[model samples]
Target: MTALTLAAAQTIAIAGDVPANIQRHLAFMQAAAEHGVQLLVFPELSLTGYEPTLAAGLAIAPQDALLAPLRDRARELRLTAVVGMPIRVAPQTGVLIGALVLGADGSLAVYTKQHLHPGEDAAFIAGQGGAALEYGDNRIALAVCADFSHASHPRQAAEAGANVYAAGVLISEGGYATDSALLQGYAAEHRLLVLMANHGGPSGGWACAGRSAIWAADGGLLAAAPGIGDVLVIARHDGGQWAGHVVVL
Candidate 1:
């Protein structure tokens, strides 16, 4: 089988700045493509930080022209990227935490957060999640910040024939221990390769704990960022083995 490269883009978002964040995302995409990464995942609300109050005003349709640059870059680099944003689907009154998938083939898909954390209901509503992403022989299930907290979420993904589980999250230091443990447990229980992308700095008044990481099917730690900053945690599956590395950008 051919090798597959995956990466977690641990980025620091400029609060409520979509244009700046897009440039940052572009930079990460370029770096990932240089490393031959086929799939890259970024933190929840990466395009607009984790500020819920700003989400409503910032929400746009999935096909908004604002994302054209990102889409073009993905097609040019032949890299598939899952980027987080605030989006409102037609007839949906409330904003949803969206993971927008930009396929290498210039296709677009959306994955909304089905589960809402406690305080989130004030700013957003739970949404019907999107479909898993299929690349080569791998099927990937996507999760926004709070979705992975529920065991049923990952279980359903595995039952649906997903071999890779990727989550875009904004985890704070206080909740890091519990959250990371849950993600790792899911990996071991489901025997699915897991990848987590987290914010590299504070956002939405929360001090984020940026230790983005990846684990093999057995829950073995493959690669992780030491702390916080703009970096990429990459895992490569080749020759029937999984290996990892980090790129500080």
Candidate 2:
């Protein structure tokens, strides 16, 4: 079987700065490519630093040409990257938290948050969610922040035949313990590998809890960032064995 390498990009965002954040993302992409990573996922609203008030003005259509640079880089490196941003399906539609899949083959896919935190509804609408990503023999299901809070979300992914459940979130330090435990529990109960990508610093005024992580299907800790900053929590599966490591960026 072909080896599969996945990484959670633990990055700090420049609040409401798309240009700067894009540059940072490119840097992470380069680092991940150097580590032979095939799939990389970033934190929620990474491009805009979880700033809800700015989402409407910052939101872009999924096909907007503004993402050309990121798309070009993904194709060049043959790396599939899932990046977070605010999106509007139509000019008249409300904004939604989006996780955009930039495929190595130059394909684009969209996954939006199906659930929202209490106050989030004031700024965004609940999405219908997106499709699974297929790579080699592995099938990946994508979740955004609050989407995983709903028990039915991951359960649906398992029923859909997804072996890997990846979530991009902006978790605050206070909520980290509870959230991480739930993610780990899902890994055990659903027998699905779980990967979490969290913000490395403050965003939307919340002190983010970095420590991005990956868990084995049985809920064993595979790899995790010690604290936070610019790092990559990576997991590799080859020859029927799983290995993990951390790369400081």
Candidate 3:
């Protein structure tokens, strides 16, 4: 569990197609394993391409077979993968936009989105708060889009002694600059290494700004996707310093 390398993935996701997206995720995970990444993160609602209109019907149950391939791949590669999907909050009630953490030991953990965007609440239920996953000495906190924008979100992570803050967002071109600045602020103020995973193609009918990136605890950019396609921005930590590179698949 002594994780040294982490990656943020930017990839094309098929809207409303869980099986196809899972296939895409498997390919991405394969590429990440070849690059020696201990953990790989995908953008929000990656499995369903942020299509809120189809969320309720496409909500993945905890024991669904669609998740089996991902679980098996994570176990085989011995690398953790944080993937996005819509999860049922309650039976026949509604769903919560969620990030599912697949551990190398074949374990699954979920973190639901605590904050929703302007009109997302109509389809997705808001969660209570953010959640963190642990790997050896590293405690990585999970945050969806608006959750990272809130000041109290990082504070909560700081209170929990988290060393990494990971986010999955579908940022448009116009919003990238502002969101990146805010994320950098979180990295500097909280001393948490920040990482973001975003879509490489259209999702939810929005043209996504594909710039999956990572920032050092000191707020310096470590790595970022060049343009689009299937890309990975990876950061490796050594003796308190981080070195990074971008991998194209």
Candidate 4:
């Protein structure tokens, strides 16, 4: 079987600053690429912070120029990057919280959040269905912040034959305890390796709890971030078991 290396990156997002955030994303992408990572994931709303008020103004199209650098980088490194942002649903419509996957060969695929949190209804529209990005022997499913909270969200991915469940979130320190428990249960029940990319600092006025992490297929905690700064958590399956670790930037 072909081995896959996955990375979940946490960043301190500056609200409404697409250029700054994209630059920071590039830095993280570069670091992950250097680590020989094949798939890199970032936190929800990573390219435009978690500022719902500014989402419409900052919402980008799938082929926006702001993403060119990352595409070039992905192509250069022969990797896939799942970067988060608020995407314009359509002309004169609304925005959706989406993870846009940039492939090594300049292809793009998007996975929008199928579920929205209570307060998110005001500024975001819920997406439909689930998507799994295929690579090698892995089918990695994507999830946004509130999507992981709903049992049905990951179940759809599991039922679709996903072996990796990766999520991007903004979890407050107080909520981490509850959120991590859910992720653990997900790993155990689905029998899929779980990965999370959480914000490092304040975003949308919430104090983010970094704690980026990787869990084994059997629900074992493999590696976790220190709840601050820029951190990348990686996971890989060896012949016998899944091994994971963190790389601080």
Candidate 5:
């Protein structure tokens, strides 16, 4: 079996600054590549920051010119990266919260957020069904910010034979404690690897909890960020259990 090393990155996002965000992402990507990480995950809306009201204007289509360089970075580094961005599905109707997966070979897989927060419903459309992709020896199930709040999301992924449940979230300051417990419970119930990447610091007038975390199948906290600044957390699944610590570099 091919071993997979997972890296969950928490970044301080600059609101509406796509270029700066991309630069930060590239820097982390380079660092992860140098550390021999196979899969790297970032927080939801990492590219454009989580501004629900402004998402309509900032949303990018899948084929937008801005993503070309990001795609190139993934290919050049030979790393699979899950980057969150606002997606414009239609011209003016609605947008979607999406995580665009760029493979080392330049292929792309898009996972739209299945569950939208109540506040976000007015701005974005929710996706239907579940999706999974193969990465090394693991079959990864993707989740957006609010998807992990629903028991059915992780349950369905477990039922679908997913060994890894990955979530990209923009966790606000108020929601940290609740979300952490929810994630722990989800991991325990499904007996699957739970990896989460969350935005850190304040952006677009909102402050996010920087507690990006990874849990083992038994609900053990394998790695967690210190609720401040940018963090790169690495966790290893050894003998069907998650082990290792958070690396802030």
Candidate 6:
């Protein structure tokens, strides 16, 4: 396909409800597939929601029972999906905040949040590797929540020859107003297309903003979801620019 169709869903999940979250994510993936979207992205910590209190108890190994269905869904839909979850690597080391990329063929790749906020430092470990995955003629670099706010994060992706950068985020109510502009700025400076998926409703006693958005390499906002219930935003890119309609699915 000359034009790449990308979609993101801003959905909510109660803290620690893995089954429901996976079901919701699968529903969105199915919708994206039906719409002929090549890739679908979900919010950060989407499987378990942004519940720091449950980090220790909820953390799961990368290859665990909880994620098997998601892998199957990706293969079944023949769609690339990015989902975030808290991962436990070792006992001494705390959990790591991670986003896993499931290729249409069932291949797996990952990107962890290298920078942890003050509140997350105690519960999550910072990731060191910077990686990018190629799919459907697009070099996609994946970033976790808060990673895109730093200049080095997007710069690393751009330097790695990534034309598109995607972030799975949990943007709290107050945090959205400040960080959204910064995300846009990063895209502009790096000359890369940026896509961010954020949680929609309340989770862990915190209200979240569901305004998932897509920005052109020039930093122009192509599509933005109003902060509300679950919503999907789609953006198409052609000739290194966003030149398509913003469809809500």
Best by TM-score: 2
- What would the TM-scores of all predictions be? 0.98, 0.99, 0.96, 0.97, 0.94, 0.93
What is the Å distance of residue 146 in model 4 from its true position?
0.7
Q: Return the TM-score for candidate 4, rounded to 2 decimals.
A: 0.97
Q: Per-residue lDDT for 152 in model 2? A: 97
> lDDT per residue, candidate 1, 28-123, as tens digits?
999999999999999999999999989999999999999999999999999999999999997568899999999999999999999999989999
**Candidate 3: where are CA atoms >4 Å away?**
1-3
Name the better of 2 and 5 by lDDT. Answer: 2
Candidates 3 and 5 compared: the better one by TM-score is 3
Which parts of model 2 are misplaced by more than 4 Å?
none
| Residues 1-249 of candidate 5: C-alpha lDDT, one tens digit per residue | 357788888998888889999999999999888877778999998998888888888898877889888889999999989998888756775788889888889988888998888877888888763468786678889998899888999998999888889898988888888998998888898888899999877866777888899988889888899877888888866575556577776
Instruction: Indicate whether candidate 2 or candidate 4 has the larger lDDT.
Output: 2
lDDT for model 5, please.
0.85
lDDT of each: 0.95, 0.95, 0.88, 0.88, 0.85, 0.82
1 versus 3: better lDDT goes to: 1
Q: RMSD of each candidate?
A: 1.0, 0.8, 1.4, 1.1, 1.6, 1.9
- The lDDT of model 1 is 0.95
Q: List model 6 lDDT by residue over 1-249, tens digit each.
A: 246888777888878999889898888888888878778888888899998889788888777777888899899989888888888666667788878777889988777788888778878889864568776567888888778777888898899888888888888889998888888988898888889888888887878878889888888988888765787788876675565344454
Candidate 1 vs candidate 3: which has greater TM-score? 1
Candidate 3 per-residue lDDT over residues 50-80, each given as its tens digit: 8999998899676577899999999999999
Our tally of clashes for model 3 stands at 0
Report the poorest 10 consecutive residues by lDDT, candidate 2: 1-10
